[model samples]
Target: MDALDGRLIRLLAEEPRIGVLECSRRLQVARGTVQARLDRLQAKGVISGFGPEVDPAAIGYPVTAFATLEISQGQGADVRAHLARVPEVLELHTITGIGDMLVRIVARSNADLQRVIDRVVGFDGIVRSSTAIVLENPVPYRILPLVDQAAAE
Candidate 1:
């Protein structure tokens, strides 16, 4: 992506509600140019979806936890399907190391977390599971810095 594209992304990241006309005015480009850039970015999969970022904590799920699952051999797909049915299972990753899969989950409380974990490991393929509760988030998830670095390059 070029400097203009970077600027457009940064602008949108800062103010998602802004229109193409407003973006053109702020970036000093034509409305069509802004529109075209946004369209191209979406087509290229650089900008995926414009969905609102929801906070689980704000939605009554204050507790965040990560669970590592050791599944039976050749049961990754089955385990994944099972986890997909659970609403609290926010993110899942096929990880390397001791664990076969790592899942991020949220719950209303510590008691509720146990129930979530129970559901997560209920599948027959899951042989063992370990959980680590997140106590704090000093650095929240972000991509702006990476985006800036890419723009600089």
Candidate 2:
């Protein structure tokens, strides 16, 4: 990624609806150049997708929680498949720690969260689990600073 690509990504992150023509106008580059850069970015897996970001709170599942699952030996695939069938499991990651997998889940309420957790630990392979409810988000997820740093480089 070069300076031009950095600028283009920043612009897109700010205004995702802008088309290639508008990007070309703003960046003072040819339309083909903007289009080609975008194409290359996507091809290189830098630009993953143009899907709209959805808020779980807005969609009725406001309660957010993280769960760490301790599984029986050699059951990662089975546990992962079981979690995949659950709609409330938003994201899952295998991390090096006390637990085998870390999962992010959401629910309609506290009672609903219990239900989600129950489903998560229902499988035979899961030995134990730990959970923490998210009370607030002081610093939400972001990558703009990294993008700017990359641009400088």
Candidate 3:
């Protein structure tokens, strides 16, 4: 990874659908060179996968929230597996903070959100839980810093 790779990542982060020919033209490099670099990046897992970003509201789930979960002794895996089965749960993460797991959920409305939370809190070994509803999502997602690319030759 190098300046070239950084440039490529920045461009792709903005537009993952950009073609190799367009990338080469923008970077002033040969098409094959752009293709090779992308292949190498993917092979090394620096570049994962790409896809469209959809709105949860447009998909019928208008409500979004972050849930902090506290589990009973030795119930982390059980709680995690239970959360995974729910379609409303968009993302789940284990953290070192006060909570055992953090979950992102989307629902249709307040009633829907309550239902989802009720089901989640009902899971075995779940001791306590809290939620913060998202009033607005200003910056949802962004590309990670390309440290390897920063140190490239």
Candidate 3 lDDT by residue in tens digits, 38-146: 9999999988887777888998999999999988989888888899899999999987779888999989999899999998888778889999999998876765464
> What lDDT score belongs to each candidate, Candidate 1 first?
0.95, 0.95, 0.87
TM-score per model over all chains: 0.97, 0.97, 0.86
Q: State residue 2's C-alpha deviation in candidate 1, in Å.
A: 1.4
Q: Which pairs of residues clash in candidate 3, taking residues 3 or more apart in a chain or in different chains?
A: 1-152
User: Higher TM-score: candidate 1 or 3?
Assistant: 1
RMSD of each: 0.8, 0.9, 2.5
lDDT at residue 38 of model 3 (Cα atoms): 92
Q: Which has the higher lDDT value, candidate number 1 or candidate number 3?
A: 1
Candidate 1 residue runs with Cα over 4 Å from true position: none
